[model samples]
Target: MKKNQFDTKLIHEGYKTSEYHGSLTPPLFHTSTYTFPTAQHGEQSFAGERDDFIYSRLGNPTVQILEERMAALEEGEVALAFGSGMAAVSATIFSLISTGDHILCSKGIYGCTYGFLEMLENKFGIEHNFCEMDTEEEIQNLIQENTKVIFIETPINPTMKVIDIEMVVEVAKKNNITVVVDNTFCSPYLQKPLTQGCDIVLHSATKYISGHGDVVAGIVVCKAKELADRMIPIRKDIGAIMSPFDAWLLLRGLKTLAVRMDRQCENAKKVVSFLQSHPMVKEVFYPGDFKSQNYFIASKQMKKGGGVFAFTIDGTKKDTQEFINHLEMIKIAVSLGDTETLVQHPATMTHAVVPKELREKMGITDNMLRMSVGLEAWEDIVADLQQALIKSNSNTVC
Candidate 1:
């Protein structure tokens, strides 16, 4: 079959109806183990001489399909699927680094990722430095002889701070460091980091990739076969493999990702515009917002501004709670990239685990709100926010 465009590829890539007796959709192979055709076949498979599924923890037909699709989507040589995003994150970190090796990462990242890195440092003797990865000079200043990996999250969680991936890649190349990017916020539909020189692109498929918010999964796409080969054993031994059921769900999600992302991006742009102009909003952090510090870099790397954005309400913590309580259409939720619009307070919700001083340094303030715009009509989303803002401000003297 001819390779089609991205939208067409979403449904057709890495799959064929003939393989499943003309079934239109990929069949879910839910069995924990696959039967070998012969005793010799089983031995060969176990000996790593045959490319066959032996166990679900090692590999599965349904999971393989999802991995192939993710690899194609990410423009990577191979992709590995995991039970959760943090599983993929931890596996990648462990696979790449050794004790005494150092990792340089962006200071503003998911709370769990921060915690995991801390755990690695405290328990395993791995060292890490978290800093503003805004410039080559800053990155160089922080790098040490032991620095082996540089990890970053673009359009960083709750802040929407876009990192310059290509620039970072250039710096990493000079230092012989591996560059890993968490592309969860801007799924492959919005950004392809590997094309810009990233070594690996990671995602929390629980969010936008699954689209419906029904599955919790993660994926790591490697630009080089060597890197992928190294990660496979780590994942297999760790037993954090994605389930056949969730893989099937992710396959279904991939079919609609193109359309879902398009509509969500449109809605997000409109929502950002409204928030930027609102009297109750102090600041809006969105890639598409021209006023954003990283707008130019975002435009270069991403096709759209994505569905998620952050903004601060002009109020105290009490007023922020009032606003959240007044929201009727948008749900107060921790996870994002769902069909229904969701909003959360980052300082108290997603990034709450981070030290208060560190959270403040990262600009995740108590009054700041992260909004994940969905496929809902933009007008309704804006109306909901407008009312919430009104209710939050009504009791205030200012």
Candidate 2:
């Protein structure tokens, strides 16, 4: 297959035509081990002298195809898949950092990622600093000689803050630090972090890449062969390898990512406009909002505004719950990047483990809500929002 463009790459870049002329979709190879042609061949495979699969933990044909496709989409040299999003996250971080190393991360990270960093701090004696401010000077000052990784999530978790990936890479490169970007919200279809100078880019493939909420998976794409080599041991030893069946599912999902995201981005923009005009909304944090402070960064880095938005409502946690409960079509859920719309109160749900004071300080208040816009018609979604807002207003009246 010619490695043409992203959309073409999505369908054909990964796997070659099977010699057997099998089904169009890659079939599930549910074998534990491959039979060796001879004793010397087995010895060579086990010794890492030849490129051959030794165990299921090491690799599978289906997983390899997904990895290749992901690597192409992400524009990375190689990609690794994990059983779950956190598995990929943990394996990547663990592969990079040691006991005495330091990490500089964004303040408004995904809840579980924040927890992972906290655990490492307590148990591993590693050092870290959370920087809410993404100004180049602020981040540069925070970096120490021991800083091994500069971790960030663009259009950050629930808040939708955009970090300048180029600026981050420039700063990290000065001190020879690794730049690990979680490109979950903006899938490879919308943004390619590795091409923007990030050392590694990982995603919760269960999200946009899968397009459906049926599977839970994660993948990491790295620019350097060395980083890919480093992660291989951690992936195998940690035992978080993605299942062959899930890999096949992910491959199928990748085929239509471009189309799904196109509609998703459009719907998200309409939703943002509606929220911005609503009387109940206090603040709207969509990258498409040109007046936003993060707009400049978003314009520089992302091709689209992405499919997620976070806005503030004029109410408490109870009030927010009322609004969510009143919604007709949008599901009140925790996980994001699905076919159906999802809305949730980040402070109380996603970021609940975060310290109260810190959460409040970061603008993750009880009044805030995060929405993952789906493929639903814009008018229907807006109508649902209208009804929910009515309920929210009525609750205030009482």
Best by lDDT: 1
Question: Candidate 1 residues 227-289, lDDT tens each?
Answer: 999999999898998999999999999999989999999999999998888888899999987
Per-residue alpha-carbon lDDT of candidate 2 for residues 302-334, written as tens digits (9 for 90 to 100) = 998989999988877788788889998899998
Q: For candidate 1, which ten residues in a row score worst on lDDT?
A: 389-398
Runs in model 2 with CA error above 4 Å?
20-22
Error of 1 at 398 (Å): 11
- Residue 287 of model 1 has an lDDT of 92
My TM-score estimates for the predictions, one after another, are 0.98, 0.97
Whole-model lDDT values for every prediction: 0.92, 0.90
